[model samples]
Target: MRVAFVSMTTTRHRDTEGNRRLERLAHQLADRGHDVTVFCAAWWDDYRDKRTIEGVTYHGVTVSPAPTSFAARLPVLLARYRPDVIHVRPRPPRAVFAASSGGTLARAPLVLEWYGDEELADSRTVRLLLREATAVVTPSEMVRTQVRERDVADERSHEIPDGIDFSLIEDTEPGEEIEVAFAHPLDEAANLDSLLLALAELRGRDWSVTVVGDGPLRPDYERQAADLRIDDRITFAGECSQQERIAIYRGAHTFVQTAYREYFARELLRALAAGCVGIVEYQAESSAHELIENHRRSFRVTDPQELADAIVESGDLERRTIDEDFARFDHRQILEAYLDLYRDVQESHGVL
Candidate 1:
């Protein structure tokens, strides 16, 4: 199958989880003998218009500040590619309109992917996209529920969770200190202040923390740690490479997340896969708690103190077992599901 993926950006332009996931999926599909082409905006370098990374081809569309110009060019681009199916990640409303129009022009089935809780307003543009889409895919049940409640798509909607590349997992011994790790941009929504306050509750405990990722609020978080008097015990490792992040997860004995909103907590899953005892705070917008399997080794806390307690008591619990059956999140399985969806859409729409 020849698949064309339309998104606003790619990992080369921005190192975001969504972009990374798209890049991984494109490569996986290509490795499985499916031709994959990704159409994205030229966000970074202006010199190159097209490039192939690994096995997947990437075509960069020069975006104008005006939405009208960008939307006008999308159909032309899509027609030039002439792919069998079009997969779109809708964020900006104009992009969705463009992809819908382009899919129609190319006579290809459109697959709209909802990755976050995007509140759909009652508008003609949204209705048109929903009506034209061959299938609506979401990364979690929470997102699918939102789509259904908003009447975005009917029985054509699917819940396909984001997957991890388990081959990246490396076996490593746990560190000496009861190292608790959390990786997120040091922004207000990260709720690092809560995590710091929780750690302060265990002042003299033989444990330390490694906070990965950096952002504009790093200085504020650093000051908060100093004020809590746990600065020495907490290390702000700043933004790390993917390998460094995996290594940190593998070495740590516990992983904790206190983000106020996370559409899908891939970091928590990675940590758990690396054998870390997971402890996630319950946030209405976050689905992090859904990943916890073993109640004894993992926990869902409501407050900072409970998070601290979970970290302390985690020592008594053995490392959570991740059996083959639990490894359904493997990217291979995810790709197969996507392939099946492509076939369904092609067959139903009578697209050869």
Candidate 2:
């Protein structure tokens, strides 16, 4: 099958979970003997032209860095590539344009892969645009519920959970020292301020706490850590590659996701795959709650004291249970899910 993926950016341009997802699906499809092409904005200064990477071809179309203007170029690229299936990743402005234009220009079925909240788009316009898509894919049941509640036709939407590439699972033994890590861009939404306060309560706890990933809120978080008087116990590791992140996850005894607006916590899964006990900030409506409820090895803690308590108790849970659940969503299974979705879209629309 010939598939064309349309996204605002590629993994090469920005090392984001979303970008990595697009790259993974594209490469997996290509490796399975499917013709796959990705259309993205020219996000890099050096590579403004079309090129191919690891069997997946890319068309780096130049457009406004903004999604609104970028949408205009998608149809032309879609018609040119003429793939059997046009798979679009989340970018509201572009989703609107792609769905609208694709309804007319595209001879193949159109699928929208939603990785984030698309609440930014005008609801009326998005509804009209969604009418154009043959299928809409979301990574979690929470996201699927959001799409369904948005009035997208039930038949057109499918809930396919986001998956991790378990190939990166390289677990290091719990060394003499254990580090509890919380990773995300330091920001107001990260709610790391509350987490820092929580960690401060663990003044003499045996474990060290590290915060990986960076953002504008770094200084504020650092200051908060100092105020809590646990600065010495905290270390900040900035953005990392696949291997580095997996290594960190392996080495750590616990992993925390403190974000408020996360759709699906991918990093937490990576940590679980690496045999780290997972702790999530408790939010009734958030994806984290669902994860902890279903996974016995996972815990949800709201206050800093509770967070620290969970970390302290993580040693009691069976690490193998945590590893087993994540292993189920390994890369090979993820690849097969994409293949099935592609085949469904193709057969439904007669693209094949």
The whole-model lDDT of each prediction reads 0.78, 0.72
lDDT by residue for model 2 (1-352), tens: 8888887766655676666667788888888888988777775557456777788887766643556656766777777767777887666555546744753576778888776554455776666656667788877778778778778877888876667776556443332234576777776668887677767777776668777788899988888788778888788877877667776777777788778867777777777777777788876456766656777677888877888788778867654413766777787887787778778877888756
Candidate 2: residue 38 Cα off by (Å): 2.0
Candidate 1 deviation (Cα RMSD): 3.0
Given candidate 2, what's the lDDT at residue 1? 82
Off by over 4 Å in 2: 8-19, 42-49, 60-77, 90-106, 117-119, 171-176, 318-322
The number of clashing residue pairs in model 1 is: 0
User: Candidate 2 clashing pairs?
Assistant: 198-304
Candidate 2: RMSD to truth: 3.3
| Candidate 1, position 147, lDDT | 69
